[model samples]
Target chain A: MEGFETIIFEKKGQLALITLNRPRVLNIYNVRMRDELYEVLSAIESDSDVHVAIIRGAGEKAFCAGADLSEFLSAPAPTFARHVRWHRDVWGLFLNLPQPVIGALHGYVFGSGIEMAMCCDIRIASEDAVFGLPEVALGFIPAAGATQTVPRAVGPGHALDLLLTGRRVGAQEALAMRLVNRVVPRNDLQVEAEKLAEKIAGYDQGAVRKLKQAVSRGLDLPVGSHP
Target chain B: MNSIVKLECDRGLAVIRLEQDPPGPGLADRLAAICDELNYNTDIRAAVITGSGPVFCGDAATAHGAQAAFSLSTPVASLNCPVIAAINGDAIGIGLELALACDIRIAAGMAHFSLPEIEGGLIPFDGATQRLPRLVGRARAIELMLTGEVITADEALRIGLVSRVVPAEDVLNVALEMGREMAGKASWALRYCKEAVYKGLDRTLAQGLQLEGDLYFLLHTTEDRVEGVKSFKEKRKPEFKGK
Candidate 1:
């Protein structure tokens, strides 16, 4: 496994585990982390040896607290635009990837973290995880695909409520809201996610991939117009 | 400025209103026709669809006689350009479905949304069942569809139902602005990307990748790619012809 400066990208058997490496700032996304994430995702996407991928953050503080606010504040307009595009492209890779990506979330999954989790096929969170999109409160809307993807995950009303108010919800609330698939104790988050990933990986990858595509694409087609 | 359809164009943005007076009739058909026509016209890059008066759209079952209203799925899926729904007022049932079909939706501060089909003793036969879950999630989607509850714009925005909430007068304007922004991008890239993204959703990863590869190959053969590259090299904006 290649050593990553901003992320811990390791291969365990057939699973590629990518951990957001920052703990002090709650693993907030900075330029280096963002670029490294893109690189790691690209590696996984092209690596036939890796059958599945799991993303989590180091430490118990947060999976991510969203974008690094200091960095965002210092960026210029053109830089910001590029950052936005990069954000989209990276998440697009996750969403469009053929293999499954499971997000192991805990602590604060706010702002861009929520957006990133929304891109994953399945999300398993620790009972301690808290989720929200507090971007609006900061005077910016979710520019990363949250505006487009969150509704697809939760529904218009719930998605809008979170986006508009930037309110945070705990793991139980998240599960009840169906924002995440399952919630377990903080210590069991990784183990449970890996178990789920292994179960998915044991199946015919082709079928899993197809099922994902069918649900994602079929819903967008005309009603009763499935081909 | 006809009572059925009205068009306003400014700065390359097209605002198409679905207008009908009191007791409006057959408005869905007219709106569908307008969408089809606008899609076919190469000159128009982006469009905002809204109602002419207090209603963003009345119940499609009422104004279009239920059976006559166009299927929300087909027309919206076929449109090549970005479409924004400016929900200036109430968007209930089929009206809400129509709004969801658009790529982006902006609602007025006073806008209200609901899925009343189940409460009315009829399952939403259109794309609502499929789209609502995809737009929100299965749990919340079920809650809304099962209960037929009406949510206000504030609630809608909080939950990520609509992108923005503006004054009733500004909904159309904001939607139009968004349309123009989308139109300013590489048109062919946007079109192919949209097609690929939507199409890929229904396929297996391998199938989706193949589809993406084919579309990507097709795009690479177009003049827009060359222009896009050239403009990037020149550090200037690319003027795309949609080809």
Candidate 2:
């Protein structure tokens, strides 16, 4: 919380809010941000008082426009890159969090931004939000769970449409595809996300966690094998 | 002409029509046997399962029949070729279960889908409890099964239950068109792709990718694949011999 340079973590009642704090660069996910997020998420996972969490950006322009290419594009030795990635499985930590994570999306959510949002259990986007997965156009594929998660969320046809074409999707269009749970005015984005988090937090924690686990685990079973 | 189902195979496309008005008590076993026949029938490339009359299929004769329906439904999923369900009208109870067993479902605009087994103090025995959630999401599946809610074709499409909803008269035609299109593709690739996708569902991403990569390499070694590339270069349609 204190040493982090790229994110601000705050606890409010039973809800924890983690804001992507690099507003000047549109909250681009730099290496520092990754390290900081891993630390914060670890803390949140261990915190017994936190029943739910909301992830959003600090500025109005974007919610983490993706990786900081300046630092990431400069080739690190393959071994060093692997070592860094091994040390910081931030996305894995995001997915494994026990409490449901709600993504409050706004402005530009592209590439890694969309990948991160896909990790959340529910997503609420502002009407001004623009979403895209431009990795294909950038001569690479989304290394994050976008390959699997996008298809799971919006079916294969639509997932392929977005993945292959790299087209930008508006908030309304995203809602129609069931990519986001709800879309709201830009002004109400934070409050709406907060309200949902609090509402979920009010539920029986035991029942809520069990239900989440059941669906998450049960979905992996083959059709006839479901008990 | 069969008492249980009518099967017609033409140009690699097989049409399986439920002959009984209500898909009667013994329909489950008969349909399962038909599936067994189609599974190894190398001549059949794709299949469409549609009823003869207005209603695709009605409620089963007894609770025992419903149980048999569940036990026998797995064969449809096991077929080597793709199976499409052309739902012409109300698909309820066992009728809906039969449709759910198919790989793809095309519903008529007037068709209604429901899993009403719960109302009779029973769960959907024929894979609906499992497959419905897998097709749609957990929330919608739970709501439908728990409430016994009957949804329209449009609603079914919105929820991802059915791939497409066409007019009542066009349901069979649409399904046949899709069947023919799938039949025209390289048969080896079609079967291999289906195998990969279906089998991959039960695997983790890493494992699934490995399987897909293996299948891709295997396809490159097939004669059909060579013909495909050759045809592309020659600017002509490739004649696939299902090798």
Candidate 3:
């Protein structure tokens, strides 16, 4: 966890706190972040001590603006890229983390950022947050399973609107659309998310997992991850 | 232009206007032809399907509810570019279905929408039954279909039925600006993105990943794939050949 460059992983009591740490560039997801996330998520999934997790960004400017398309789409070869995606499948791991994951969102949540936030069971956004899926407008499809997850979370109309037109919705609009569970002041976002995570951690862990399975699995799940 | 459907193209953007209410007897074939041209013309990257003088499209109250609906949906659903449904007026019956088929929908603030077939003792034969639920949700789709209530544009936007609500005079321009923005992207990538997302919706997780990966691999064989990467490295726009 200490060696990971893109994320900060820490365990406090029964709560696991994961922060997207690349603040200089607004925590944009990159290949390094992908590999690090894979390692951290695999660990979180297997750790029974962690009853709940909170994911937030390190800086005030953004939760995560987007992804480093230049890095990802520039894989040296298709063969190598395909095999890595198949074997690692970070998006799949993130989607199915057994523990309830709370997203403490702020600033720009676009492309993979919005997709990642959607994976969390409950999203708490700061008033300054903005959500979008501009990948198509940028001349690439979001490969992080947002095509499926977004419709499942906010329904198809909102999903396609964001996906096709690249429209950016503010946190209040996101709240109206039920994309996020709640919107708070920027300073309270992290604490609110963590408090919810603690409340869930206080509950019986097995029951929480069963509850998640009962609802989410019933609604279908990420196209990148197995049920 | 044909009797009802009119086509206009400008630098990779195509605008198809339904010039008559209930379109025309030839609308099914007309839309099919438009879709065919959209598919074959690699230069065309985006489209706007709107109606003339206050209606996006109107349905002919006939026995061909299911058949007509299918005819309207299949062509638009199978397009090679992203399409915007610029609803300037009431989009009712098959009209609503046509709007539902497009990837993105924009409506004038005063426009109305409904899938009122259920009120007429029939179900939505076109793509509404499927696409509506897919767009909104199962419960909302059912409620809208069962009530057969016409909703205003703002209400439609509230429920995710339409993404944008604008003044009537600005609807077409707003849609065209959006279309032109998307139209600037690599044409082949646009089609491929549509394919992956649309078909991926129906495929299993493993199969969806396979389709995505396979498509990524397939692109390696194309010259545009090389050009895409090169352009990025060169810090300039890619000159996609649509090859």
Give me the candidate number with maximum DockQ.
Answer: 3
Q: By TM-score, who's the top model here?
A: 3
TM-score of 2: 0.58
- Give a tens-digit lDDT track for model 3, residues B108-215: 998988888886678887678888988887788889999998899999998888988999999999999988877776666667666766776676544555675666
True contacts kept of 2: 0.01
| Candidate number of the best lDDT | 3
TM-scores for every candidate against the unseen true structure: 0.58, 0.58, 0.91
> Which ten-residue region of model 3 chain A has the weakest summed lDDT?
A218-227
lDDT of 2 by residue, B3-88 (tens): 67878888998898887766554666677788889877887878889987778876662445434434435777788776778998
> Per-residue CA lDDT of candidate 2, range A1-227, in tens?
79889999999999999999999999988778888989999999899799999999998899878766565335464446555554676877787788899999999998789988988999999999999975433323455566566767776435544654456899988998888999999999999999999999999988888887776656566558555
lDDT of 3: 0.81
- Native-interface RMSD of candidate 1: 11.2
| CAPRI class assigned to model 2 | incorrect
Winner on TM-score (1 vs 2): 1
| Cα TM-score of candidate 3 | 0.91
- What candidate 2 gets wrong by more than 4 Å, as runs, is A1-151, A155-227, B61-72, B233-235
Worst window of 10 by summed lDDT in candidate 3 chain B:
B61-70
